[model samples]
Structure formats: C-alpha cells, structure tokens
Target: MDQFLHDHPITPRTDAEKQGVVNRLKRIEGQVRGIQKMVEEDRYCVDILVQISAINAALKKVGFQVAERHVKHCVSHAVKSGEGEASIDELMEVLKRLSK
Candidate 1:
C-alpha cells in the first residue's frame, strides 16, 4: 500500500480556509455526539437514520470542498511543475473512491 502511494507535499491554506474547515469538522463532531445521545435515549430508527444521512452528506460536502482546493492549488502546481500525470492519477483514484 505504501508503495502505491505518493508522498505528495502539502501547500498550506490561508488562515481563514483552515479555520473554516476546522469549524465545519467541529460541527460534524457535535452532530455525531448528538446521534450518540439519541441512541442512548432510544431514539426512533428512522430518526437515527435521518441523522446518519445528514452526517454522510456533511462529510461529503467537506470532501468536495477539499477536492476543489486540491485541484485549484496542488494539482495546478503539479501541472506547472511537470508532474501532472502522476498527480492527476492520484486525484482520479481518490475520486473513484469518493463516488462509491
């Protein structure tokens, strides 16, 4: 697995972007905790499923946002630096998984 993975270096995001992602994750964490509490309190099955669906959607939204940033910054850098093929392959691999 390690052999197949590239050690792609990261470019740091602006402070506001970092903070926004963190804030979104924290809200997702809170939502998860709320779901846990609902389970402990014997919440209805459909209600739990609805919250689960919401969590999945929230996570995917975050994923897409990060992907957009990667394409804009990292992929663009790779293409300019002449490593475009490898970088694009890596992105496509992750995208295939995301689609599933």
Candidate 2:
C-alpha cells in the first residue's frame, strides 16, 4: 500500500503518541536503508532476508493500528448513522483482501 493510504479520521494525537509512532517509523525507514546498504555491500543473503522480515512485521503492525482506529471511529460513526450493515460489509471485504 502507498504511504498515507487514506485521509483517516485522525483525532489530535497526544505529543507522546505522535512521537512514539513517528520514531518507530523513522527507525523502520532507517532499517530499510540499512537493508539497501547490505545488499549493495554484498552482505549475507540470510541476514538481508531477516531484515526484510523485520520490516514486513513493522509495516503490518502499522496497518493493524490503522485498522483498529478505523474500527473504533469510522466504523462506529457509520454504524451510528444507520448504515452499519453496509459499512461493516465494506470493512469485511477490505479485511478479506488484507488477509490474503
């Protein structure tokens, strides 16, 4: 998925909350660069693969965080507006795609 996939219903995050995730992502970005460097340096294949797995896990965690927020806020609001079934079905379809 693209960075900043959706214009989400982002509540004003506390400074700490904002910084925590940002720091994590910055670290992930650095790790990505490190992977590139490793490949350029002709590092061990298995080592590079391990870093790739770590990056994938980090990205999945971020996706889960966004999914949780959407369920709590966007889905909540949609359900409140009497469009719950449709909204839920849409969410389910998206989840199904993600699961794949």
Candidate 3:
C-alpha cells in the first residue's frame, strides 16, 4: 500500500491489456487485504501460509504476462532496429531468472 508511482509513464497499454493488468492488480490488492484481516484475526499458521502461496502464484502469473509483453514488443523492436543479438541475450538471461 506504500507503493509510489514513478514520474515516468508506463508504456501506454491497449484498453484490453490495461484492463487485464488492472484486474489482476485489483485481485492481488484484495488478497493482500484479506491477508491483513487474517493476521488481525490470528488465523492459523497453515491457513496464512496457504494464502501466501496463492498470492505468490498470482504475482508470478502477472510477472509472466509482463515478461511476455516485453519479449513480444520491446525485444522485437530492438531486434528489428539491429540490436537483435544484445536484446536476445538480455532476454534469455531474464527468462532464466524468471524460470527459476
């Protein structure tokens, strides 16, 4: 909840794409708020942990989506502009980390 938006604008997304991201974020926000309530109610440790796992999975799903867009757009643009090798290498490195 303490997140600060950067002055730089996000690359403008399509209505559908933006909505998709927004929906995912909203769901994540609700999950976080639910976790807060769980803590307040002193929920069982395993129950909290299950929620934590679900949140983590949701976050990673979002990460994969963003990563897919980066590869399809940003990296493709770079490759088309003749920076292909560097971009591909960079992308591979990122994919390796993400897959871990």
In terms of TM-score, the best-performing candidate is 1
lDDT of 1 by residue, 1-100 (tens): 1332245435677889989999999999999999999999999999999999999999999999999998887888778878889889989999999989
Of the candidates numbered 2 and 3, which has the greater lDDT value?
Answer: 3
Ranked by lDDT, top first: 1, 3, 2
By TM-score rank, best first, the candidates go 1, 3, 2
Instruction: Kindly give the stretch of ten consecutive residues in candidate 2 with the minimal lDDT sum.
Output: 1-10
Q: What is the lDDT of residue 74 in candidate 2?
A: 69
Give per-residue CA lDDT, model 3, range 1-100, as digits (tens): 0121122122456889989999998999999999999999999989999999999899899989988887777667667767768767877988898778
Q: Clashes in each model (backbone N, CA, C under 3 Å)?
A: 0, 0, 0
RMSD of each: 3.3, 4.7, 6.3
Model 1 misplacement above 4 A: 1-10
The CA lDDT at 84 in model 2 is 72
lDDT of 1 at 71: 89
Model 3, poorest ten-residue lDDT window?
Answer: 1-10
Encode model 2's per-residue lDDT on 1-100: one tens digit a residue: 1123245452445688668778889989999999999999999999999999999899778767767877887678777767678668878988887676
lDDT of each: 0.86, 0.78, 0.79
